[model samples]
Target chain A: MVSGIREMKRLPVGIQTAGWFDEKDPAKSFRFARECGFESVDYNIDTIIRIGRDEAGNSYSFMDKTDEDLLQYYEPFKAAAEVNNIKISQIHAHYPTYVVGDEERNAYHIKVMERILFVSRFLECPAVVIHPTKTPDRGQEREINLTMCRNMIPAALKYNVMICIENSLKRINKNVVQAIWTDVEEINWYIDTLNAEAGKEVFGFCLDTGHSHIVGRDVEMLIEDLGSRLKVLHIHDNNGTEDEHLIPYTQNPGNKGMGQIGWDGVIKALRKMNYEGALSFECARGVKLLPEGARREGMELISAIGRYFRKAIIEG
Target chain B: MKEKLLVGIGSKELLPESNLEDNLRMLKECGFESVIYSIKENDLKMQANRHVYFGAFFKAAKNAGIAISQIHFKYDEEIKECNDYIESLHNALHICNTLKCPFLVIDPIQLKDSVQEKEINLKIYRSLTPVAKKYDIKICLINTIKCAGGYHQHAIQGACADAAEAVWYIDTLNVEAGEEIFGFCLDTGCANVTARDMERFIITLGSRLKCVHISDNNGISDDHLMPYTQTLGQVDWQGFIAGLNRIGYEGALTFDVSRSIHTFPEEVRPHAMKVIAAVGKCMRKSIEAES
Candidate 1:
């Protein structure tokens, strides 16, 4: 009977898996995500790759596993998603893709990212967010990031998963300054140039609202400028200073129209551009702020805000 | 060589429960040499004979071998009345005297216009001079950021964010009081949030810096994270150490990293505090190192 009814277009609301669930059990995390009204989840693969050596000087990285073993390790996540009926919207790749002057480490990161693309495909995720390399020099940052993305094209094409470059911030002389891809035109250029080189759309933009807010960029303008090239979103809010990764509307509760990110403008712009990707929340701080007993309430509140965004974007 | 700074933390997270005796003992167990007592309105209003609870609090701190270095008065923007705010501060001074805490860190009230912000805060602090003098507590004005919504959307300089202005306020207030009654507490996180050069700010404050709120951020928001944990080099630890060393800062290395601690899983919080203490020791050593 429902098949005959015309269903309205609705964007899926999602959240990250970092803080909401037990890392030991993907099933529990996915189930919790489902219960919290999230239709999809952004799989956090950052945990598997230890950025630095442990206290004993031992390095741990799941990317070093054989393809078969890597897939086997993530089998539970796939099974959990199937059982929970929650879509795997995207996977977050380990950050600092290009380490300045550390060619050996940078090569290792690319290899890890190539493996991450394979994992993303296996998990049925359509995209992966890779942070841009940060440095004081803009030209050097651009060249290194471009080379890094170019190196990932083979893996991206093999896995059929789009590479998403996020807007990022840098610290210069103890100040928060804009990094490469923070400028809308530069981001557009990266995506377009990568896609052109790949002979297809292999690259897309992941707009991190918190990053944009801190860098003093207009969220609405960024969304509109990216247009169809925007494939993913890291929706979060802050008081325009730190990257707090807080829930939207929580920043300016008094609605004084001052220092917080303008979620209203964000929603309107997404609606105008007809953004189809999930309104995913990368708000780990939002969940962590609450005590363990009350973390579910935080997740539920974020999900409620996600639903509000979904309603506005769809109904408008 | 300069004396090593004592490591301490705010009582907000350490004192999760109401038992002051147990809380002070827990702080000592966690490797803190000192603490900043966070006084709330409830604590002020509950005690009709205020000395009863603070008396026990003082005894507990002494017994636990923890020094009560400073007291934080709850600044409520909701009160909307100057007299009520002053009354709460007056009560806080009484508790500070009982605890024998020397410094009281108070935030400057921010308003839309700079003149109004300065005038209102000056008036409020001026009103507390009499009570502060009676308690023999040096009132420390902390730097704050203004987050006024609209075209200038993000955080800009707020009350006392600038070192020159903070020095002006302290000097002016002290001259008006006919003694050294006012001092400055440099909140590193607030300074980082506003993107001020930590070394320059510290150098400017120099001997006037009575205390510090040592925390880090991503240079945008006041995340209050531990130093050197930020992915971006937002807080200049080298600059901070250099500035403190140059000034020979003798106060406690007090931290306000509840947000950073909360980021970890509940079970890992104890370990997190230990790491923070370890970092504090490292920073102190670095500051005292002959450079």
Candidate 2:
């Protein structure tokens, strides 16, 4: 309770498991995250997209796990997180959840979302990051995303967790262009509408720094616009060209004297908006590419930066 | 001429109990010498956990003295992300390498537009060719056939509907890849569903036939029934047997007929399997007599 100077809230720094590329066990990765001084972790659920499919050709995932099975499956992770004193920030749901041209398949994807909600509750997590539905009808993107939200919100409420709709960027497939909720305004619309309709904060936003950087949307503006509705963060840097989730301040290859993102600006904007969540790093790709034993140094550097930013900008 | 008939079965037949050792034992008991192995949903999770390795699975098969003639891999993801799709295929290919499986079969993805079908199929196979080469496995593309109004039609709308078109597809991939890793998996049930001339189709496959899914249909649907079922519309068994003998086809006469066998009660399945084994024995004797 120091009085004169404004003290920075000791917001926990977190890391997602996907960045621990080769590390197969979540318990081991969570231990490492704790040792590296990260206080929380964004657990990744789709590290290895195994090739086995159901009869209808849907890839099996945690969604396929029954309640008893899933509980047994992730119990070790829960124990590790508890023992390491690391908070479970959220679960990162598998991407490209939107199925095209098939009602049965779409229903399957929704079922997966419901299972994820149950998992979120099982893990005692407060939120789950869900990608917006990607479809061909750009004009109807908002409606489609809303429809998906409506479909999952009851389950979200039932599980007492929040579904954070992450903003996306344009991606092409088979010569057809699909625009997910790439625009900030549309995302704002989704959050506002969902929260308002639910009469509570049922839906929130997960600002993906890499996706925002790729689509060239202003990170600072997004914070200002989102205000308190932003519940989670996927903080990572990338070369301006691709969604390579590199560690913050890493040099972008072939781009002399320029890094992918301005971490200082992002922190400053967070301070302005007074974000309360953990400063989670989604830079596992950068971490994985390091020479075997050198990865710890990389994680240490990341944790140090997280502390530095917290003290310099957030503390002031 | 091929040495023995090498009657084969699909691993799917032993599902629900899905114990690899037990399945292999059952297949052997049923007189099956070859099998079309699939990485099912549960098996995939087991592989991820390191609890069930393909090496061990195949070793049990080897101990049972059964050969994995081909692997049926149907990827669950839509081909939206090319690299992701390629990566999934690479994992499956690695498993094939572990099992030393010689052939991998896939149902060619169907797109709405016919003109784009060839290009898409070529692009997908082209991406998979390097992995196929690395694993020393042949990629076999199966044809698309539909049954409508009691008549079978080779998919006039999808890629590689006709036998010649299938050969052309495989050849195009082979030339572009600079290797003979690409080939055709002639699904007899698909042929029957389309009412195709089995002899002509087999001749067209010629030396390019890397694997075969020898099942029967009633010309009304791809029922995956046992050969000589007679209940299904007639499969030209004589013409098909003669065509393989004529081409000197060395591949196994593998049956992807679990769908029909699975219809019977668990107790009756072994008996149904005996019937299939008898038919396979008959076919092999006939082929060997010709040789």
Candidate 3:
């Protein structure tokens, strides 16, 4: 009985399905992400992108209304994910849709957030994930961003959804998270302050392996510092330099790599933190695969991940 | 009546080890009569931007009783930095002035669009052309493709029996590019994926070519599989080499397969050779037909 108990204590992966979970699959890809042993899955929230004008001289609408419309696009995908028992976790922050200025615009953003929360609740998800903004000129000038969030959190609370602010890797010349919070130190302070002010856990942190690696932090150290407060753990490999986003044990298998984040160490770190989420993979494999092939590859990767986790962890 | 073409396995085929002596010895054992030396950026950094491979290449070629066919200026995206471009030029000029190879090979990064491609192409000439002319070494460009710039803008289409129209695109570019711009280095796996007729393309190009990146492929796609892997890349091995014979083609035959020797070494290079020998059977037929 004790031995069985010990076996059950293996890797308590607190992970979500990254769209890139299946390096190949683009369509039906999320299903593959679930098969990769990820407990949570993410989707492009606020996908009503205003790309450009069409021949009719109207804006190109990305997300049309209605479950029927969504089902028409996601029928096979939803069915496969359901059969696989994969749960939805968070929506990538729909910032472009949710700028709070006018009452009507703010109300619309609130409606969108409510709809997202409804779908997530129906899916039995615990939280919604978002990237707040591109890094601003003054790193960690969270006053403006905080004021906006302070105003917005009430609306989020009304939906009973926990918002998980994920740290984004640098783009071009800036790390997106720092524009809001200069460094991890400031991020920790903000989380502590926000939690205290709310008198409840308003938001939590999503630890992205590549982002941490890029910033020259030991990812294992982060798990150690944040402990159980670390909610969503994004599991992906990068070679310290550019975010190649490859599966573990594939890229530069010999050297410590640029990110200096090795696979075995990361798995061991996850176990150490006693994380209770999904180990999401957002990595690059190849670009040229057909959508079907891409999704199928995503499925295979998840199962392989399960096997790896099952082997790496030892329960108490 | 034909040159028993000097086929080489480039240093890249045997990576991880930068030792020219050891690589040359292996090349000899593998019976590759020619070689295209690839210099890595790390080598550039550690060796202080010296043309270490160039001197080693000349010595190894003579010692191994092999011919130095082409010196390749390896590509890296970071070459946009002036220092890296200078380092690349140093290596290229090293081969040009020091090594006995008659030609220098440069494969510029595939441009994403014709606009950036024109810019990069101009960048390529602006930076490297004078260097090639300075060393008096004939410069040749190779084509490749992906989602990026027009490198492999034309993909392989096995549907048509070696599309002659697509093959001419490369020949025409070679004509337009420049002086000392010797010709094309027809990569067969590239042709397989792009679906250009190998023999027909070469025949059409008619001797403007300086080299061949010999590799076998599975018919399904460009696997760069060892010849005989039942990939689409398999040619009548013997007939293929013999066809080069028919064209009176005399240049380097280098294997440009992309797998790292450190990981899957034992399987790939030797298989490349065995596939060549299998293809050699077809070349025998071509020889007999000619005779």
Candidate 4:
């Protein structure tokens, strides 16, 4: 019941798993998101794509089950999204596609991802997030990242899921350094090159607010830079240091001295770009760390903040 | 092995209202032989001349019987500009030199890409090598837990979370610098959360194990509780002591145990300091027995 400005261009407010939803119980989390007034939810696909190896060293396939069984597996997620009237924003895929010396593991993972794509498509989720490749050597970074998408492009096309490459940051020597796909220039190049080669919009960019904050990237400027190509968002706030993933403003507990990310500026840029995607809050960890009794209230407050931002974007 | 147990406490425990000399006196009175100093953001920001301020702070520590074993440059999260970051790092090195502290512990910020992480970390650390060498202080990169939220969002742990990565980072830095300039600080809480076996990690780091943050947790979030407080899901103390002995670690057994003590009522911290001193003594005894 977190009602705000009623307008045709009102961007729908969304929420992530937010640590309240146990992976085993998707219904409870989605229902909570719905009750909190979130119009959409970014489903964490990591729980579904569990990759394990047997004694024979062959990868155990979750997809090897009967189609009926697969339907049963997806029943909870589908029912929750339907009953709560929540749209599935995107399935955040397992990151670092190139595990060091684990080609079999990566291959097994891609197979699982292919199955998730089918489930995502069925749920009408438009996008899925896969991280850019991380290698020890910088020279092979671009090629490795492209190859990952190249291999999965056909599956993505078949399932009609747009793979969104998220911006990421690494902690190096106590300084937040930009990783692959963090730079706007690199992201533009990667997205442009990938989509051009695929002959369609198979890959796009996911702007992670916390990742941008930690590396000192201006979220508003980045949004403006990405413009129409930015398909998704992983919105969260941090106090300029460690990815604390706190709520947008410095309103939450335990954020006395932390830096506040500028949400108004962010909304201004999104409004300028006429962003049509979900305004999802990836700020779940901040609330999850609260005492159990405070969680529901904390979640409501976060949802209210989301509505506030949505209202800001619409009013502007 | 030295017959006397050498122990220290994080200077973060010292209230900002209180000056260094009074805190050092209190530490000396509490039986802490050494102190691990921390340079707060405010301390650097408020002071017009930081070098002079640090010099005076070190003078006060020397006046007391407390030796500064390590200086922690409080992690600056707002440093987005490279020039600002370098300036802060230089200030850290300057503080270390002023205090004549042997080790400076830091939590490196994570980059998105691993290659960029290695390249950027190497470049930054390499730039600081001369300052470290000139001051005769070793730079120790500490391990970190997952950023804000656990695993879902990609918050890169520092370039040295894994044992092999730590070795490679330190070895490569040292080899390039043509001197043993860098080392690793293992945080017990971080190790537990990351599922890193402390014994094996110690064995891997060997001589590169420069400093340590000793605290207990439930192996989920970083609780930073007093040792043995969390009886369940505690770190393998037996293995921890054994590994230190195996590596012939002769560094100070500093208690990064702050949350537990800091959370205590202000009036009760004095007694808590004594308890920390006793815990440090007991751990040293156990480590010595293993040796």
Ordered by lDDT, highest first, the candidates read: 1, 4, 2, 3
Model 2, B149-252: lDDT tens digits are: 22323333245668888888888889998989888888887787677888898888898887778877546546576565332255888888788888877787
Worst 10 residues of 2 chain A by lDDT: A1-10
TM-score of chain A of each: 0.92, 0.87, 0.71, 0.90
DockQ of all predictions against the true structure, Cα-based: 0.03, 0.01, 0.03, 0.02
> Global CA lDDT of candidate 4, please?
0.74
Best by TM-score: 1
Model 1 off-target regions past 4 Å?
A1-10, A51-60, A253-258, B1-291
Encode model 1's per-residue lDDT on B1-291: one tens digit a residue.
523488898876667647777877776776788888887766677768889877887898899888888998767446578897888888888888999999998888877787987888899899989988888899999998878567545677888999999999999999999888899999898898788999999999999998998887657667677654554435887899899999988888998887666654344455456556666777777878834
Give me the displacement of residue A22 in model 3, in angstroms. Answer: 13
- Docking category for candidate 4? incorrect
In the range B1-291, model 3's lDDT, one tens digit per residue, is 534555566665564446667767766765566667775556555666355645765776688787777777766655566556655665666656787667776664553364565455545545555666566667665656453235333343321123343244344443554553445666676666565556666776566667777665433234453333231234445445555766777675666544422222243344334334333333333545564
lDDT of each: 0.79, 0.71, 0.53, 0.74
Error of 2 at B13 (Å): 70
Candidate 1, overall lDDT? Answer: 0.79
| Superior by TM-score: candidate 1 or candidate 4 | 1
Candidate that would win on lDDT? 1
Candidate 2 local Cα displacement, residue A71, angstroms: 1.6
| Residues A60-107 of candidate 3: C-alpha lDDT, one tens digit per residue | 343334655644545554555566565555555566433434445545
